[model samples]
Target: MTRKKYSKEFKLDAIALVLEQGYSRSEAARSLDINANMLGRWIKEHQAQDDQAFRGNGKLTEEQAEIRKLKEQVRRLEMEKEILKKATVFFAKETK
Candidate 1:
């Protein structure tokens, strides 16, 4: 049999039906016109993302604007260092 593929949102909602509305996995799969195994896989994938969503230092938030600013400063400093090294090398070659 040729199988049809569903969108990410469709898979997420199918998984949610079983988890949030207390539907049986089989029932949810049937109602959504998807395979039970696929629904189970989507649930596991969702749980994994939710678990690691905040594994970082959380410097991406508006409250961490200072942290973001410091990172940009460090990047600029590194670029400046590279430019200085190239200039020093060019000057040394010309003097020789």
Candidate 2:
């Protein structure tokens, strides 16, 4: 068996292809010329880091923290809007 040499850019791109582009892990590994297992591990690690960073538990920038908070707020507001629309329809029907 031979050893594989992977660069940071290659690993990052492979992970992105598998994740962002929705490529299969095996396909990403084949395209990157790395082992599928290695690619999977990298993906898991990358996701962990991202999750932590988004939550501000990891070493993320202030901008990232703000973005994460804003995204959460948007989700909450959307849900509230949906609930309000449903309630309005229900009340309007009852009053009819």
Candidate 3:
């Protein structure tokens, strides 16, 4: 079965039920029809990351975005380096 995807707002609301509304994790999860363990994990993440919590698909934290950009740049540079190396070898052979 495909896993269900929860929106960031839905996760925040679920966390609010436990943190702000004083609902037990099990109670909140049952009322929302989600897994209790999942609710507990959400609460932990909300407490830990606060504003950064529940970054949905295709959303990255600033640091993560930077890292992704750097990785792409490195890949492009590596490809360029390989092309330059092949060109150098070709020129060296022609000069021999």
Candidates, ranked, lDDT? 3, 2, 1
Clashing pairs in 2: none
Error of 3 at 79 (Å): 1.3
Query: Per-residue CA lDDT of candidate 1, range 27-87, in tens?
Result: 9988877788978877887788763323344435554687778999999999999999999
13-70: candidate 3 lDDT, tens digit per residue: 9999988999999999999999999999998998998899888888998999999999
Clashing pairs in 1: none
TM-score of each: 0.47, 0.46, 0.91
- Please tell me which model should have the higher TM-score, number 1 or number 2: 1
Leading candidate by TM-score: 3
In terms of lDDT, model 2 sits at: 0.79
Each model's lDDT: 0.78, 0.79, 0.94
Cα RMSDs of all predictions? 6.7, 13.0, 1.1
